[model samples]
Target: MHMSPVRDDFRRSQLAIAALFFLLGFQYATWVSRIPALKARLDLGEAQIGLLLMTCGVGAAVSFPLVAVLMRRFGSRLLSVISALALGVVLVALSVVPDYPLTLLVLFCDGVAVGCLNVAMNAQGAALEARYARTTMSRLHATFSAGSLLAALLASGVTAFTGTLAVHFGLAAALLAVLVVVARPGLLTDDAPAAAQDGPDQEQDGPDQEQDGPDQEQAPAAKKDRRRFALPAAATLWMGLAMVFGTVTEGAMNDWSALYLKDVVNAGAGLAPLGIAVVSVMMVLARIFADGWRTRFGDGRIVRTGSLLAGAGLALALLVGGVVPTLIGFACVGLGVAAVTPCVYVAAARQGSDALSLVAAMGTTGLLAGPAVIGFIADATSLVWGMAAVAVSAAVVSLCATRIGWPAPEPHPEPHPEPHPEPLDGRLAPDAG
Candidate 1:
């Protein structure tokens, strides 16, 4: 019945990390809820808007390649705080940017912030989960869904009253920035890879070896570990692909769900955001339950089940097209896609910091591509078909789940005992002393 101090630290860290996730979701959902307003303010066509939205992807592509390097040099904890603050600033700027080009620039910067937060926060989550020796990432992610759900519902009410993005966004930004600053202390300060490195280094250099041994005593093992830390191309690619599929579904919901409801389902302004909110609500509920499911079923099975659920849900929405059925569909999709990214990140983290960063960067492409792809499809065919992309991506995720090969969680390493001193007389030591 007694918990160790390490468990306590991990528990506190989990709450802190979950707060960051919630803040992130709140920020993102606020922006998404206002996209319809921004689209109207700029007087842009669907294709043009989608193209501009792709600027975020451009920023993500630029930033993703740098996550590992930046995380190593600055540490994920610091980077997360810095980036969250920057993202808040960017969100505010997005509200008031006068022209489309400026909006693109601001959005690109927002994308950079998004990419950094993804890497940094996931690093923190993975570290905490590793420390606790259990599945925690999904629950942290569920907090994000809770934030998004709240934001959407709040935006719906606020827009009905005020009809302005700037006021809503500015208030949220100020509050979110303050929360990020307050939460900064609780994040894991050191890189998980660095912690992994420390273990091997201490093992190679015993208490006795520390006094007179040359640094080269551990050179071979250090060199091998360095090699292991190199990005594993195969693992990174598969995990990234899985993330891409999951994120595509997520991105579609974030960027297009409201529009889909408004344009295709013919929902009224008051009801337009309801579908998206329903999605968020279902996602929140699913993620809340995902940790237990992950433990009982493992990542692959859980993700596969979720993906199938999401696909069926989207397919229902596409076929039904009416407001009622669409809401039901989105809710189903939300439940289905909830578990994919959390499980993927947890799996990636087990590989090490390098793999975590690489997989996160790779997965971020879906966030960038999802809106743009949907926009293009909507332009060419119809919003209904564009919505089909969510179903398709969900199906792809289901297919990729088995290939993810969810390995068992890595075992925690035990501390080594100090070596006893040799007697000055040089007699043989007792074997069972």
Candidate 2:
């Protein structure tokens, strides 16, 4: 049977959105894989590098308000494309920036672009789910992990050939440009809230109903004002907390896994990058099947179980204290927490766009800043302790998972009742009740 145009559009949009996710992950991992090189080139201490990361986080944290406004004005589609292009430009700038201050400025800009893209792309994901009534966010996130895996492998390969940031990041940026162009047309244009597009129709409302027109107009404005200052619900806060903790575990590993291998395990330069590769590989594999698990087990059970697995597994690995065990632990962490953020994002989207934006921003902060926090911890104590903190964060995610209200499983449709036989008489039969 031939598919309708709408079906084709949906498929295209889905692929396009997945590409956006992949783009973000690939760009991010390219830089993240080079953290060790950056530290050495800048001749920075762990604490100083942490401070640099903190700057990026600060930029991301402060960007939510601006991102919110931009989303309202431009809609998620345009904003996603624009921010993605900006991210590519920022990556190139990062490669060329010479001084420490200039580099920090570029990173701050990168953070802003990242924050905007994160919120915008996730909004698109939520919209896709709403329109299609499917659980796709997890699979979309899997593409992200795939991108990271590719970047890690590429970084390793490129390092062997040459150690030039300009060459590596330039190639990554070119790839991003191609993907952004390919994905833009397929992104959903009608992603804005329905209320925003439902202009007053004079023909629909009779003269008698005109009296309520002003009130109807004022209602949205009042709602908007209230939303500006309103506090998040307890459930929303819990979800955000889970996101923070979940991302802290994820982000810390992305930034520090190599260093942990190099410094703690003495894995040497050749093997250090594999730490990130291991996590990305496991994350990609787990996320590939996470949506199916969510359908069967529900988001709550999956999150709680996964978080516990991640925390306990990592903690055990640290205790074992060897390169092989540590790599195994990172893989566990990846597999266990792979679905947490996507589940949390789905739950937050159900709350409304405001909560979604807030939670996404919080997650970005965790992803960017959490690694820096680990850096400071490593400086003050040891890298092992810093990784222990990641384990603790994973445990906290499990705790928060228990508290937050997850979406209930969709109820099965009931079977149609059998038709009662017509009464012999002309009159209708009496009700059983």
Candidate 3:
């Protein structure tokens, strides 16, 4: 099979993007496995650790708006490359720093870099997809998930074998260096037209359409009507809610799964982390394979179906007495949540490609907020209620999907033949598996 959409020049750019995303994923949860070490080294209480981690959120939120400027000015390549490299270094710095205040500063920057890179990569990837004939978003995302899985293994192995987190972070940095060498060519220096480069061969493959609307040919208006921290468009709001619900479950698994396995199931300490790891492994696997399923099924259908499965899975985890059932429930939660988030990003980018950075900035802030709120709720109420609250939220996410901001399908105009028949302008067309 061909590596690119049609043996295209931009193939390397797509590959590079895939690699960048993969490394980003690898970095995200590596710290989770190392948190115990961090806690012990810093002599931090749970509350202190929580407060310190919250600074990461603040940094991420603060860095988002700056991405628009970075993308607009220095262009995507240098900005993204710098961010990726910076994060790897900062993570290492965080590991070695002895002072609490210094560690907090390093982590804050780490969070900012993570947040900015997320927006930049999606925007860059979406543009690259426009340059190529087929869809690359889901596959790019799959690559990221692959990296997450790798990080999970590395996390477990390195922690068990050596106490130092710096070595693993150094390896992650090395991967980022390799990624920069591979994926930075053929990408537009500015947010220039996608079709100008990739349009020669790509058949416009939007879902069925009617007569084109004014917005169809022109740029999306997300930045033109930007808001600092306002509610997203109607569709975005619903999609964000879906993410909030899904992430509630994710956070609970990350925090409370081991406890549940130990307390509820009478598992040993050694076995407890195993239960949580199993759930996380399932989640990473689902993101790799199942996330792209939405491109085939409409986002609405996937959201509706996924919610029922997720809710059922969560309920089983709560009510079922057997460990087997709980594991399966967590697996279902993973599978159900995988597609919804990627779908939201795809929708947001497609709808507001011109405002791509702004859309991502807003959406990711919502993304970060989800887990933070969940943790706070868990602390406020009992952890049991927190998990149950997550179950109920899944239903709401599926319900909200029906009302998300997908552009209304257009009617194909019979009288006029269009140059490209894509659903949105360089917004999103499905990628090859």
Q: Is candidate 2 or candidate 3 better by lDDT?
A: 2
Predicted candidate 3 versus true structure: per-residue lDDT over 1-433, tens digit per residue? 6544334445666677787788788887677557778899889999878877788777876775676556545656677878887877877787789888898898888888987678767767756544343445656777776877788898888767778767776766666677666666644454433322122122432221123553562333223224322434454455556655655555656667777777777767787787667766665676566534544555567667887788878887788656777777767777776666666565555433324554454455555565556567777975556666667777777887776644222132121222243433533432311
Note each model's CA RMSD in angstroms.
8.2, 9.1, 6.9
Reference-based lDDT, each prediction: 0.74, 0.79, 0.62
Return the lDDT, model 2, position 119. 81
Candidate 1 per-residue lDDT over residues 1-433, each given as its tens digit:
8866656666778888988898888988888788888999988789878776677767866685566567766777888898889879987898889998888888888878887888789878866655444678889988886778788898888888898888888888987888887787788865543433332233443453466574654565445545645636465567778898898898889789999888887889999988778887788788888877776766778888889988988897788678888888888888888889998886666555566776777677777777778899989998888888779889999887766647452243221122111220011111110
> What digit string (tens of lDDT, one per residue) describes model 2 on residues 1-433?
9976656766788999999999988988888798888888777789878777777777888787777677767888999999999889987887777778988898888888888888888878866655554567899998886888789999999999999888888988999999999999899886654313221221233342366675675565436524542766677688889999999999899899999999988897999999998988888888889877876777888899999999998999989988899999999999999999998887765555566677888888788679889999999999999999999999999999887767554342121122111111111111111
Task: Return the TM-score for each candidate structure.
Answer: 0.74, 0.77, 0.75
Q: Which residue runs of candidate 1 sit more than 4 Å off their true CA positions? A: 1-7, 31-52, 92-102, 149-170, 194-232, 253-275, 312-330, 374-389, 409-433
What is candidate 1's CA lDDT for residue 134? 62
Best by TM-score: 2
- What is model 1's C-alpha RMSD? 8.2
Task: Give model 2's TM-score versus the native structure.
Answer: 0.77
Model 3 spans with C-alpha error above 4 angstroms: 1-5, 8-11, 29-46, 95-98, 129-133, 152-172, 186-232, 265-271, 353-382, 407-433
What is the full ranking by TM-score, best candidate first? 2, 3, 1
Give the winner by lDDT: 2
User: Using alpha carbons, what is the TM-score of model 1?
Assistant: 0.74
